[model samples]
Target: MSTAPLSAPRPSPPMPRRTGRLFALTGAVVGVIYGYDTGSISGALVFLSKDFDLTETEKGLVNSILVFGSILGALIGGKLADALGRRAAMLIVACSYAVFVALSAVAPNVEVLDAVRFLLGVAIGISIVAAPLYVAESTPARIRGASVAAYQVATVVGIVLTYFVNWGLSGGGHWRWMLGLSAIPAALVVIPLLRLPDTPRWYVLKGRTERAVEVMAATDPDADPHAEVAAVRAALTEESGGSVRSLLRKPYARAAVFVVGLGFFCQITGINAVTYYSPQIFEEMGFTGNGQNFLLPSFVELASLVAAVLAILIIDRLGRRVVLLTGIGTMAVMLAVLTVVFSAGKLHGATTWVGFAAILLFTAAFNFGFGSLIWVYASEAFPAQLRSTGASVMLTADLVANLVIAQFFPSLMAKAGAAATFAGLGVLALCALAFAAVTAPETKGRQLEEIQDYWSNGGRWPTAPEPGPVGAGPLGGSAASPASPS
Candidate 1:
């Protein structure tokens, strides 16, 4: 009997390594959609509350349902993508979110809309984990830091765009328009995912040797796929059992702690708080000159993208710890200045703009360091088999923290005032600096499998592999793909 293609795998074609720009573009689109969906709510809620007769707490509740729902989605999305493949999984996530966002536009009242928004949050969470992990698993290590960073960059872009849309549409009281517009990007994702190949790492893990090869070929056009295929299969099959449970044992535990802790610390710095409430916070601080225009969010996005691009260029050379510590520490200083300015009751007009500039500078520094580095580190800290689960754990913590602050920021700004909030964030940034100084290890210039073994065994350097043939399969691919598994 003749075996079918799935049963009898074909040989992998010659697959060339793609340029960093392709990966960056792919990542940028995904990130921008993520940012837009999440940030659009900031403006959408204004009209939503009026249309639905939502109370202050009710409005917060509706807005926060998304974050709360995303927590579970982020955790599960990683495992789902790892098992089902990043390309397919992402398509599912995008479509699901598009439907949910569309549903949100037709809700009968605040109650139903809040529930739908929560569901949409779940979709957003799925995209967040899947997108970054996919980019990390697919990109080459040389540009992994930046490629994964495409998540942050895209996020800022999405935020900028969403705000622009909200600002434009707000005048017409077209709340539904803002909610409905997200479907465009969701639709945009469907096409790319169809074109995008599965993560090479996923194929190796599934023992789908031949498909893995073909997928890698599609990702890059010139390199021989056979050599890389053999290498990837060897790494997956040869590697030992590594999963979420294994990450907490012995040497790997340190890496886990650092990842989770830093992930926690990153959110605590009030980045999410600011992101979720940028416009509201500005208004509360008496920001008037910017005129609630798209210009503000667009500038923030520009600054963030520039920082992320710069970070992608220098991250490997500077080391993760150095970049994160430097950026967060600098952010703390800015936050301190912001605190003093706000506390002195000099927060309106020019002072507010100066505060906004301080915030933008902090955003740039963050993208240059922490924002860009988090996904890279998460993907790298885990091994071939455990990346998805590991990323899930870290991201769940991130999502939960995001929910907490997003739900509270407006109230915090109102009750505690800008001074206390900025002061509190400065403290969190300080904590992040100290944590990185102590626990983080360097992954600069290292190969993927080597880095895995090192993380699994306390940064023990792996014996360098000889430079093999271009089509040598995955001889050098593991953390090198546009998206790492984690």
Candidate 2:
């Protein structure tokens, strides 16, 4: 492939400026499907239980089966993305999402539905890992946090939108429609996936530097394509093969611990408990009316979404450590307050309002920090070579935590009541906060390759490392620009 002359004065035509935003927006469809799948199920569960006469164990099974499938998806999907490329893996996920979800909608019995949900689970799992990885690879470091967090924002959009869908379908066993409607967005996302280019990073990895440069120029015209291409080549040169064994060693192993911890805590923060079964939670809080149950949780999720938007705006400025610590601290406090309020016994009037406010605060705080940060952190943590596989390691941890919680939460509620369940989670939240304080690094404006050095140092970088070949330019590393031809 011909290279751009290093000192050439030739003017290159500008690519469309809107490319980055459009790509990020398209990638967020994965988040929408994730939100819809998770958020919609809670509402549907209420009606589904009635239809199937499901026992508590069966109910938990139904809720957790998707997560179980997700675990498998993340494990395999990460490798799939690395091997087949991000765009292709996403295509597979999108098609699977449309097919399985549609199958789920028409399932004739609980056994059929559960089996289908598990299949659908695989698609959702892959979508979550591949989408953020794509967005991270495609955007510049300056806005990487916000761009990837766009997935989380899209998740909130899905959750908030699905709440309304649930409300509309809440009548007399229309749960099938709620479960199936998700395919529309899945189909919509597939349209863009069909047209989108594979990430430049992936292109570079495949030694298709010419194509990589083309993608970069289109995405960010201001970038010096030759410098960016050289940086990517250098980074790839330093990297080893992305074998699973490699990821399990020394620096990568230690990094995996941090990623896994973050993923595990992200789920155990009680966010899912509220999101997945908010109606039931409201009922426990003494709001037995259907409107209060559904409407309040929807509003809570809206608050959560708004908080995520705020995170996106300030994440680049505040840095990951500060924002993450502050958010976790706030969440821990709020969860404690929730435990206290709920423990004060089920009540009416002002107390109920207090409970609602507490729930809102907890949800908001979680979305502010962990919701967006988890994806940002996970997507950026690994070296480029193992990016997708490393993401799977963490994502698998997340889904494992999710599966266990989903399967046992209802029984935990039945056994110990909501207050105790929340109190325990609050304790876990404090532990998460402690973990962040001890190990989290500042990765606000660093290139993806540069960020890996943090883990290389065992998560203690008292000062920033020197700029390396991966992003050694005025604009910093292989940025959004494409390479110019010689």
Candidate 3:
């Protein structure tokens, strides 16, 4: 055997490029739909509370229960997506949530609202798991970051659009329409799901080698599909990838803890509270008066969108750890300031302007690192076999944390008052800062193959600086076939 191999075997073929862009676009649309739903409830809750005679606490829970379902859904959704094709599972969830979104409009009371929200949360959970993973797996290494950022851009766009929709529909009775409208986008996702091809990586895992090539061609029509398929097959063979069990193994468990823990911190830093209740938080900032004051708070969404764009641009350049640290650090300071501003019980004319400005700044900081990187980091932090499950576990925590904050925000605001409520958020932000400083690794510009060994090495930045793609070799370098084309 050794005597036969003095020279290398024939190189694999090349791949088409169209397949990558198509998959990336699909991811962007899914991101938009998910993001839209995340904020849609913010404006709809007011009307919903009235229609169902919900108490303040009930209304908050109604808003958050869906996120709780989303948590569990994220955990389970990943396993499902991995085991049963990301496309298939995402499509199923898409249909389920679209129906439920419409059904939510007819909910008889808070009880039904909770159920609908929970189901919808499940849908969003699935979207979270499938969308990011799809972009990461499907895109060419050259454009993976940009592709994933497109998803982020879509999410922010969805949020901004939701705010505008909320503003347009604002009143005592527009909540039903708000909740129901999510289905429209869900329906739209169906068209793409039907047309967009499945992931080639997933196909290879299923042993559909020929089909994987076909998908590779569709996704990257300009490149050599067979070569791409062969490279993917080689990568998969070497990866030793599979279901969720590998995630719990000792080696992976270490990385899983860091990634998931950071994810948890990302969720509980009071960002969701601000997103869900900016209008209310602003009111407490002593900017009372229903008309323009209420509308003014909505502008924070614009800040959030801007922050995401900035983060996308800088993430690869600045490195993940520093960005996370900076975001967490800034958020901590702002939350503390907000706490003082609220606790003091005095609102100068400038206080209102400063208050809204600070809130927007806070939104910016949160989005800059924690918001955008959470999805990207989560998707990349794990080995391929356990990628979905591990991400799901983390996102479940995220969504549940979202629920904890959202479910009790109004009550917390009522009981502790604004100062304490915001102070709590400040404390959480501090913890995130500490977490980032201690545990988070710089992942900017690293390739997936180089990423796996990162866990084995305890996430130390390599000193040798052997750069091929971005990070180390096992998961980093791109494989091109020489047999077919240049």
Candidate 4:
């Protein structure tokens, strides 16, 4: 009895490497939204304060309340990502961003603006968790650093783009447009994502093996789909659960210490302080004439983008620990020099130039190492099951530190003066350096599954795969359609 003649074998559809590219590109829109949100305010505040007649404390609250909102979004979004899915969480974030940004634009008073900005922060926080996690999970291990670094590159682009936007809007009382324009891009990012699927890792965890295999085929065509499925299944089986509580155990707990420290220090070391207040800082350094205050930081963020590109080139080669240490060391030294320069209280001539140059150097150094690696490392430091939760926990520390720095920076500059304020930040850089030296492991060239084993094995490097076909790495060529799995 020919059982209806076993259906002729189905052919495996062509697996386009574009899947990986699309993954990074789509994830980066969130970064653009994030960058624009944070950077636009730096310029908008110039007008916002004037119109509202805001006090320094009021200014600080407006800048910092977004961070407070992000803290809540991160914690809740983490659970949502794990419980529902990454794709869903990101969709919610995008819609929220568009709606809240429009609301923020229309607010008539400082109190109303503050409330809307805080709600907007919730969207930023959720995107922070969703974007990096999606990039890390969706790409192959080999190109993971570059893929995540793309997010940083997009951030710098968004920041730089806002500089121009802020400039165009500067001549008019158009700060509202600067704040509201983000809705356009937020809506744009959503359109492409509608066609995208939840990550294969999430599918595997949910026991949707068929769907996982389909996604894996598209993303990493050379890898055996069944092997990929089995690996995720096995990894999940070895774990007790995928909750935040699970992350507080054994090897994961140790990794958490490192990640949390990285997150907290990443902010407290004054990166965001410099970014959010570059114009004010430049003005204080006597670069205010001729619109140089805004122009110079626009140039600096351009340099930051270049540094991010350099990081993508070198991170996998030099390794995370080496790059991070180098970055922290350079930033600390630059901050120290600025401390000395500001202490001299020189407002013009060579001294002013020296302080200005130091800010440029610090901005470049940060994006080169710590800025690029922080998210990449945080995303990789946890196991598959705990990645989203771990990233959330890490980012929560980051935002808390961000809130403290943003809220207190003006007051600190007032109370301690610029020299002492930067001096405190410079010292935090030393602390970050020490933490990396002690706890940060080299994560280059390892699979996500392999990284968990590496951490469990007392921080040993995982066995490296032998070099394979050209373009076989994560960012490689399209695959020829093969016979479907029998």
Candidate 5:
């Protein structure tokens, strides 16, 4: 009896290394816009309060309105990314930044400044969703973690750059110049994006097979375009029934919960509370004066940049779970230290430096884990069809948590004291450590398609044998073609 021909396994296609790097660099530019805006506000608020005669409540509102706007942006960003395409969505974000950043520089009143900043937040919301997704989709699995981390690297660089700008201008209080410098970088992002194409997976999802193949060829010359395209199509077929709500159902729900929880906890752990109010926090610790306040926080941001670089170097090697657990644990310890220092009443001499050291170490730990990995996790955690939507949901949670911290942190500190406030954040850090240990998966070296398959296989990592060539039987199983692009 003649046996039917047996199917053979094919090796995974090589990633588009050069093209992936280019896309990653482009995402970094998007990150620069995000970082500059986030950091600029921290210093600008100092001069802004004086210029506007602001109260603590008003300061909180000014700081938080941008985060609130980001919430609105995150809500819409997913749909925009899906409907308009990631490249187009990011282009819109870049243009919006140029306009709003310029407007922020020229605002005649705090109301107008707040309104402009809110609009800028919308752009930020969309870029954060689209940029990392753009890089994650374009990059090869081997270096995908590092490539995505590049966005975080640029983000830290932007923050550090802004801090220096704030310091230079703090001498003269050139808050307008500080906010406006970002417009230059915003305009710069548009140039590279104009030349790039949407991700290959996105093209496949849209059923533009020819374009997808072209992108695959350009990005990964070593890749088998036909094989990769078929794999994507097979993966898309598996996700044909997916929607925003589907993320709350079986398989996908675990990922959604992990990602959303990550987003929420990353913020509530007090990274932004430090980023937004570090100068003020230091001032409260008795390091007063405009130049002196921004000067110390600049070092804090520098430490964060160094930690982000370290994450880029080791994220893939150590895996997401290891890095996250280490970082969160360190953060909890540092926060506990800060609680003790703050409880000693206003810091002086060695105690003051000790408080500074704790803050610096806390931020470094934060950047190493949560800041660097959050985007990588958000971008890679969902099926191709739901990638943007999932990222949006995570970002929305992040911004909402950030809003609470920004809006109520000062009041909380006043009412409960700095020690109590930090103790609360410390508690949250411990909770995050447990949550990450229990829920966060090791995604290093896995292809995005394999990750989706993990979810489809009921919470277990997919270990089924690789199938015959694409269209033979899904990559690992059978499913229908993806739904028509929305």
Candidate 6:
């Protein structure tokens, strides 16, 4: 309840540098577990379906059940992160992952496996919210994009690695091994997290100024920690509270709409459909055998991994809006080509290669833009006080869109065929592109406090007033170039 102005100078402490990177890297490891859990099922489904004698609907349920759980997890994730702290919430999620993956491996029946995977989804759900938020809060604005993109990079790595694992075990159809080995990575995440402090922003929110300054000094060596703390406090002072309903009012409302829309479009444009059902799609396109199915998707995933790395390299330099618009536009074009190829009838000979190339390019384009930037945007969009609450809302919208695709994609493909499916997704890609063009803000190197100010100032990215003492001006004095028109 202390509302003391941050203008008073605080004691500065010498803390180690690059600790912020450690936090980002640790969050990326969690992304690895998330990716593994998501991709493992893609290869495992073929064998698991045979063993369980699952119908198409049942298979879709098994795939989507995890997303359903994630929706629940995401709904509560904001409160959990806010109350328990990001590091503690992640610890809980990591433990849940280990337990659920183990249960999933030993599940004696399909029903049990579904139940366990749903529980696993809850863990994944919380992670998607916590991991990026942690990285965003802990790292400096200079490398924030790359640092957060590391999570996406790690995600692609996990997917590619899981695909390889699936191919290795496919000879004997060892789906259990594919699903359970992720627990090892999940267990490893606890180590760095145990040593890492909660984000300075979180500390400031709780009114622990001394600790917040200490952590900020360590994480952002270039900035005056006292200034940063003052800015965060200034921004928080302007906000009423971090309630969900508050997001629907004034300055925050536009942000809420943009973030939720971004989250929904990020999923609904058919990335998960390809991710979850690549093998089946390939099989329908005339690829035969588990080896071909799994091997082919591995190549596609590898392209995504390469593109994710590219995102890390260029996101800060090129800015979020350019990457989002260009990547989404490319995806629409690729989907259009895919729709045409599939409509030519079941792929064979030359058309098969064309379809493969289209899918590969589509996946790569997606990873470059939507996959990497989604986290950055989600993490940076809201005021620090409402960061978790806003993220939870966006993530819930995201998972709901994901659930719809995962639950219905199989049936959609079966009833309408690949041509129509690709066509529908292509239209969505177009919509997402237009949405980004209109609404996405360029948050290239702006500090978190500056971003909060952008919302408060009626959507204009605030330019810094004349420089004063390091932390003198309102909202922590730092020169900032105006953002490009959103």
Q: Give the TM-score of candidate 2.
A: 0.91
Q: Residue 31 deviation, candidate 6, in Å?
A: 0.5
Better of 4 and 6 by lDDT: 6
Candidate 6 per-residue C-alpha lDDT over 387-458 given as tens digits, one digit per residue, 9 for 90 to 100: 999999998999999998998888888899888999999999999998888888888998887786576556
| Residue-pair clash count for candidate 4 | 0
Residue 140's lDDT in candidate 4: 80
User: Top model by TM-score, which number?
Assistant: 6
TM-score for candidate 6, please give it.
Answer: 0.93
> For model 3, how does the per-residue alpha-carbon lDDT over 171-280 read when each residue is reduced to its tens digit?
54477777778687787878877766568778777777777777767665666879877766665665555555666675577777777788788878888887688666
Q: Candidates 1 and 5: which is better by TM-score?
A: 5
Candidate 3 residue runs with Cα over 4 Å from true position: 1-17, 217-235, 238-245, 461-486
1-486 per-residue lDDT for model 1 (tens digits): 322344654554444457334545666776777778888777788778887777888887877888888887887887788778877778888788678878888888887887888788777777777777677766666667666766776777777787778778867878888878877777776776676567777777776666766666665445466776676565565445656776677656777787888777777677877666666766666754545633476577678778777776777777676777777788889889889888878566578778888878887777777787787777777766667777778778777777778778878888898899889888888888888877777777554555655554344443433466542333232222232212
- Residues 400-426 of candidate 4: C-alpha lDDT, one tens digit per residue: 999888888878887899999989999
Per-residue alpha-carbon lDDT of candidate 5 for residues 71-188, written as tens digits (9 for 90 to 100): 9999899888888888999899999999999999998999999899899989898888988888888877878899898899899888888888988898888889988998988888
Off by over 4 Å in 4: 1-17, 462-486
TM, every model: 0.87, 0.91, 0.86, 0.91, 0.92, 0.93
- In candidate 5, stretches whose alpha carbon ends up further than 4 angstroms from where it belongs are 1-17, 466-486
lDDT of each: 0.72, 0.82, 0.73, 0.83, 0.85, 0.88
After superposition on all C-alphas, the RMSD of every candidate to the true structure, in Å, is: 5.4, 6.2, 6.9, 7.7, 7.0, 3.8
Worst 10 residues of 1 by lDDT: 477-486
Better of 4 and 6 by TM-score: 6
Per-residue lDDT tens digits for candidate 2, residues 330-371, read 999988888888788866889888888988989888888999
**402, model 6: CA deviation in Å?**
0.5
Tell me the TM-score of model 3. 0.86
